[model samples]
Target: MKNILLGVMLLLAMASFAQPDTAKWVRAFPVTDYMVDISDSIRLVQVELPEGTSFKEKQLGLLKGIYRDAQQDTGTIGYGRCHLIKGHYYYFTINHKQSGRKPKAEDLLYTMMDSKPVYNGAITKLASHFIGLQEVGGSALYDRYQVFLAWTKTDENNVIDSIVSDINYTGSYFLQSDAAMNQQIKSGRFAGKGVLDVMMATGKDEVFKFLEYMAIKPNLYAGHEWKVAEIFATWLVSGAPAVIKE
Candidate 1:
């Protein structure tokens, strides 16, 4: 009898959360076509959210990451952030007006605060007792965050260069497995036609490019460049697939 009562309570709770007030939670924005550079090679095009997707209330969930804003004078996005939720990856942006300040021209990235997450099941639920929150971006306007996860391959080098650049910029290379690459790199035991070979060919060029990237954005993360290089080096070696399968 006790177990039955607890189960009933759980179902009721889920039902309450699943059926949110659409009027307060949902909003729509007009779609505009443009490109946002995510890396040296990868550029993002805004994609709209589905008709009924909603954002969770701020008290219900929160997301932690940096984001991009449009330049007021130039009308271009020269600054941005990448989403590295527990594991899933995305690049997101919010409106500068809603943000209550113009994105500083010198500031290439802004860390998000009090930003609400998407109320979607695709996100991983945490111990906070609320549903999971997914991060997204497209428009800077409210309720207009378009999902940014879809991918279509254009060129292998483009994919490789982009992911390598993203990994460096977001410091997400730290999240990837080294696959025992450190030892191989140190011992110079790379076998041809494999990860090591790829690294050998393009590693130097990528490093030089990353240095240039850092020169341009000095406010980027500090003290993690070496690790970033190590992580993305392996990614470059591995062909830098758009979706990193876990």
Candidate 2:
């Protein structure tokens, strides 16, 4: 009986959360066609959301201050904060914005505060949650890429660079593994080519090129280069793209 009662209570809680027309704020922007052309390469998606969403002003102010300091200290893109409030749901998007291209790690950080599992789940979910809260509508391009960018003093090892190197190394290993299996099969030492080899050969170049583009043509702010880079990098590395299952 106790278990049954708890189950009923849980169902009620879920039902309440599912109620509609409860969102209060939303913001939307359009994604350019050029961005769409590279969407697959970078693993990004275009989306729409509402405008005038409620955001935590105080936090945003503090983040802006931090970004100013970061710019002065590193000359790289820093971070900014945006908030969303809907019924009882609240979150933030520490992102970068650009006029012509996608942002980079040097520009933005799409983080969610006041939510469980910080840095949890897909980047799209964070965007979607913000949109849902605003209850407004707009669209923009989103790269579904996942790459890290670390910021450290000049003398310290760059954390972001280290992470990027690690990813590339892992990718290279997979490529080599595929090559080995192929050679063995051609020599009649194995049954046939393995799936791992095929996958490595297929999307590897596209992924590498996409990362390079991000590093070079990263989206930028009107006058704040570092701010743009930080936001863009955060979005790119936050794991927004759907994982391809082997």
Candidate 3:
């Protein structure tokens, strides 16, 4: 009897969460014909919530799930995130779910691009987080963050040069295992490497090019590792903490 009651309660909770108020109000990411042309590589279906509503993580249960399903029905998406634009909170999903045919961006919506993405105050916030992490004194984390922190001191010109150098360089950092990587770090194997090496270890060049793509032409990096690179960029620019998933 107790188990039955518990299961009933869980179902009720899930049902409520599955249709939260956020889902009541939503639309597409202001799609335009010009946007569709530039959006060829953009895999996510960008949806905007009603104006004047702030995005609360707890309130996104249904909203997230709704988009997750939408993504499945759309072939362009690979992942997702909630961001703000034009005084409204917008959620973008990399739409991977689809039937036999992929939808064109022009068919997704009919609107014009109104605003652009800005780095905003994220750079300063990112710096503060790195400082806090370094003071905590975890050797591996410190090594990882140090590269980003060094980025704080340089100009865009130097940073872009380094990114290009990594892209042009031929050496790839491949490791046999996590243990081997830790051993490499201990031995200073990647000492002269650039900022991206912290997250990707040996995939620095790839990460650099991806991030550069995101910075210079975000829509061009629709799928294929864009979200992970976005997460790392958010960490470096917005001070989001690192989450390593093995």
Candidate 4:
């Protein structure tokens, strides 16, 4: 009896040790390499604001100034960049157009206009709500042409809940294809288990948190009609589990 109990305990311990980490969760994506590029860019730009300036204040001022300058010079809307001073440490990608190219600093200075008070007010509300939920560490990206906003993981549980609730209430668009892309990886027989295994090994909680965020709204990326699943499949076939070949 004693021997059997000891064996059972050992088995359980082994299983726990075998569980994948959070990094593995991210690795489960077949298109992880490409996704890595995007993720890396996001990570690189993540920032936290200074104590005195609020995220809302910085965003509003930056947007107003940039928009005003752009209108005066080009007589059109353009992309801009804003830095938040509190909570999260990151830069935001403000859209002026549909192209994925980076906007010029000059353009960033031109998006601050007083003409669209109503629109600007709504934007302020939405931006502040999202920033409020973000962990002290996360980033946001705004698609100018589509008027869409997307965010990454943060460390605060309360902020996470706020972000999720706000997105649901606001009916904001998100990157649905990213979730679908991850789902496809999980659906595969051989690769699915492996991906989950890796994610569990890396950061299970973080991976699940990201998954939950994606499950919240209609995917804005879906409008592009790009078959992210297909892209993921091809990437998997070529090479997956970036840390390990095959």
Lowest-sum lDDT 10-residue window in model 3: 127-136
What TM-score does model 3 achieve against the real structure?
A: 0.22
Q: Write the per-residue lDDT of candidate 2 for residues 161-202, one digit (tens) a residue.
A: 333343444435655755552222232212254423322233
Off by over 4 Å in 4: 1-76, 79-155, 159-190, 194-204, 208-246
| Model 1, span 166-214: residue lDDT tens | 4443333222455344323322233334443444344435544433333
Which segments of model 2 are wrong by more than 4 Å?
1-54, 57-157, 180-212, 215-246
For model 4, residues 64-114, the per-residue Cα lDDT tens digits are: 112222334322222223444335443543433333333333222212221
Global CA lDDT computed for model 4: 0.27
Cα lDDT of model 3 overall? Answer: 0.29
What are the lDDT scores of the predictions, listed in order?
0.29, 0.27, 0.29, 0.27
Candidate 1 segments exceeding 4 Å error: 1-54, 62-158, 161-198, 201-230, 234-246
lDDT of 4 at 47: 27
Please provide TM-scores, in order, for all candidate models, with all chains considered together: 0.20, 0.20, 0.22, 0.18
